[model samples]
Target chain A: MTIKGVLFDLDDTLYDSTTFVDRARKEAIKMMIDAGLNATEEEAYNILQRIIKQKGSNYGHHFDDLVKAIEGQYNPKIVTMGIITYHNVKFALLRPYPDTIKTLIELKKMRLKLGVVTDGITVKQWEKLIRLGIADFFDEVVTSEEYGLGKPNIEFYRYALKKMNLKGEEVVYVGDRMDNDIIPASKVGMHTIRILRGKYKDMKGKCKYEVKSLREVVDIVKKLIEEGV
Target chain B: MTIKGVLFDLDDTLYDSTTFVDRARKEAIKMMIDAGLNATEEEAYNILQRIIKQKGSNYGHHFDDLVKAIEGQYNPKIVTMGIITYHNVKFALLRPYPDTIKTLIELKKMRLKLGVVTDGITVKQWEKLIRLGIADFFDEVVTSEEYGLGKPNIEFYRYALKKMNLKGEEVVYVGDRMDNDIIPASKVGMHTIRILRGKYKDMKGKCKYEVKSLREVVDIVKKLIEEGV
Candidate 1:
């Protein structure tokens, strides 16, 4: 099939979400201390990180759960401080990787349908695109919120294929995860490119392409078109 | 007396606090709405900006007051969201002006004491210097919190002079405000230079000198030493 479209995972594929998130989290802890939290910055951050690890980043109410864990009950002052600090810093520091914009621009010149298939809150994923100043670049955005299902679900990848009105073999799927993003999309019969960065960089994943940066995605797409892969 | 030191204001003079604070405020309002505030971004920002104006930026409870004013009573969820959102964005966006570092470095090479004197919470002011990575450049940081007194008060200027162990005439004071910074320091017999930027950019202030940027301060100090003024 001829390659004519590209689908992307928002977080690690387009941007280095890990480093900024780390700085924002630390700043949040410092601000929590400033907001009358009883615990030290180190103690509070360690506990929060533990909770995030256990509950996952999107379980909702991480701060709400964190304050209860720390103080043995819900404390409005403490919980609010953590919530405000974490998100404000998070969004303020939001940015795409250096190569993301140029890569996207180059892909657009290829006359391809560009879309985002992300597992995150609908508004927040949209907020990420908007803040990164790349919202207008995409033709469609498919979030887990819209389907009430997320990655690793074979149907989710199929749904994105349908949204772009293209067959799986006609497009390339690029993301940074093995279990949920790469493997599942590969099963859906799409050309899958796993960006070897972020949390899953060390995890070995079998895919059509294992590249280090977004810039390479453009060339792969060009080669696929020329070779009719 | 020969000039031997320089004292500066923390905000406007040392950095372009206005631009960053404005961006951070707008981002805070956007995040607040995401956190479940009922108002639109424009409405929330307008109300918050008004509150900051009325109570002044240093008012400790702007978010708490905003929640009360908006919902007609205290709502912990909404209030906490605003509080966490505003502060997190504010601190994340903190930055120094482009010329601030080079000017400080040049002045340090000339062996000036290089101190900061102005108003606001001591800890918060210290946080600014630290976040901007310019804390080591200053020999002293005198905030209103130290003496429970702020600018426009001649005694505060005198206190800064005493701390540096130099007569008022032997030091140069650089600040953006005419009333609180320039006039008082001038009254105390110091050389005063007003940076023509920030809220006071257009206001005509009578001082020993006025300049468009911090870069000019280095030249002024050089001239002072050469002519022994």
Candidate 2:
């Protein structure tokens, strides 16, 4: 069990994605209210929140739904206002947790190869890394969209291991979701670290390690490497 | 199935609780950052959000945990600042959805008994109704704490129906959580309407009806009453 590489999840693993999205969407709702949708700011906010809850956080037609719900039709002006406000607020606020950079640096210093294996569009995942200023820390970054495969697929984990020039048992995969990160990685004989955060925190899964923060991963990696794993 | 009374859940059923809590918690984190916490505002915000996610929304010692996570000790001043900011922001923003009052009024006009059967402390749930200005709309309000019981407990549904002088089959129970509202009511022979909102929206459960808005409940009640249920 000579651990060579440590992989991570992006959203909710290294950053405060829930807070960022909540703030961004709330600001977007305010912009919609100011644009004369004939509702109070809170009413507009609730409507948008409801639509997001129903559709999901990444749904592209949020503004379209917002306009229809508030004004009974799609007003491009209002939709544009909302989209601009949401993106502006979200991008401005996107940042890694305080311990993220320090922990990554510490892991890198331990001579363990670091990489990110995320499930998202290629550009969006790369943008997140660049925005957080941690793009250089990874030896490799694999996004399912770019790889033409998604997580829970053992092939994706195998691909990441191959890119790192390491065997499955020699790398540790860390992610927030059990189904996406832990189960498949474990299936491939890779030691899995389930970071207890994000949407799937409550989901049950199999993993060799479970930690509350990325900072905790440093200690676990150190122990495993010291013990020849 | 003739409906004599309609019952509803409080949080997220009558109001947008997810948005409400997110706004309040973020404001509280900001207050923590400003009040001599060593971390940046984003760091403080992330720490608090993580703790909330781990401990749950109703965990009583959130401020204690926030202070411990940021400052490494329990400082009453920081705790007080966080608590005051969180409560002020939450109380100021608490209000029902735009259609809540209108729908309640419409149901009243239909000459049907209306009530709220919720699981929470007595004063808190009552305060929400009062703050939303819909306290007078309900002929009866039952809190699990007041009744010495909680939801999914058949006794709770039985109590609300008994208070309204109605049989179980003559009442319709609407709630956001299927476990708390739909299943138990259904078990008691009450027609259940699961409002597709809140934390439990995606959960599977048995119910006689499902709706996206409180306003939709008015139509459901009208049809049921007209059909002589």
Candidate 3:
């Protein structure tokens, strides 16, 4: 029952993307409106949601596809407008939770294998990770963009396990989503931890293990390993 | 397939509690710091999450419990500080979505019965409905707090159907949770339409039928009523 590998979710879990994306949303909406499109801030969000349904969060690809989708009915100028606004938003606004760096440092010192399994746009996630300075802590990073699957998809979990060269039972997957992260990881035979600090903090009753802070995870894993469960 | 009654979720679908609660969180954390309990905003939030988990969101009853849980461990002064800040953060900010009132009006005009099935404290949710001015639209309202059961549990849905005096197949249940709303209702012979505007907007799957906006619900019900489905 010893955990030989650990998988972390990138967005909100590693880097606080809620604050990061709030700025991105505002800029993106202004660009859409200023470019003579009839879309409001709310409509831009609806468009983003539609894009996610179609493109699975690869912002590099989604950006162009969103413009084309809008251009199918509206003026094409909004595309450039959106691109410029997206670029002007600083990535430095992305902040890791206060304990994240210290916890990751402790996890690294423990010599456990580290992995990042996330549903995020390739360029955006990488940029944010690098900015947060914890990118180097991960031995393997699997993204929905690269792997062609998202969380709650068993195949994605399988792909991460394969890449890490670890059995499902040897890995502990931690994330903020109950259905997407905890349930599917547990279903795949990994010990799942629901982090009660991020977007899904208020969500209840879906994970095998729960922790309020990342620091607690190290102790929980040690206890589990000692108990052989 | 004529629709006899409609059921709705109370939290984010009919009332916008997400924004209100978010504002409350900001105020609560700031109060904790101002009361000298925490040095930074993140620490305050950490304490808040701890308090929420230990207390369980039980209609301000948990507020006292939250203070007791954190009392000797942290600063006792912060206990009294977060209460008024939590209340003033405005539960009333929750308003019916724009098409909500109009759609309910049209459904009322059609003479079909109406009801609500929600998962929350009844006092909190019913007050929400009344504040939002949609209380008059419901023939009967049921909450998990009243039954000690939450959805995906068919008993709660069954309770609502019995109160409305309608057979399962004679009513249409509209809600945003797929597993809870569409799946359970369909199992009990009720027609289900998955609303795409709220929590389930990002979810992918086939339900009985899917519609993007609340305005579309009126049309769906009208068609089924006309065809006598």
The number of the candidate with the highest lDDT is: 1
lDDT of 1 by residue, B131-214 (tens): 688877887778887768888888888888888898998898999988888899999999999998898777765777999899
Which stretches of candidate 2 lie above 4 Å from their native place? A1-229, B40-56
Candidate 2 B-chain TM-score: 0.91
Residue B62's C-alpha lDDT in candidate 2?
A: 88
Can you tell me which runs of candidate 3 are displaced by over 4 Å? A1-229, B50-71, B74-77, B198-200
Best by TM-score: 1
Q: Model 2, residue B134: what's the lDDT?
A: 85
Q: Candidates 1 and 3: which is better by lDDT? A: 1
Considering every candidate listed, which one attains the maximal DockQ?
1
Clashing pairs in 1: A84-B84
> lDDT score, residue A163, model 2?
84
Residues B1-229, candidate 2: write the lDDT tens digits: 5888888888889998988988898888787677676787788778877887899665778887888887788654466567767877997899898889999899889788998988875656766776677876988888787689988899988888888889988988888987777888888888778888877789976566888888888888888878887
- RMSD of every prediction: 13.1, 21.1, 22.7
Candidate 2, residue A68: how far the Cα is off, in Å: 50
Models ranked on TM-score: 1, 2, 3
Tens digit of lDDT per residue, candidate 1, span A69-169?
76787554445556656766887788899999999999999999999999886656766776688876888788897778999898988899998999999
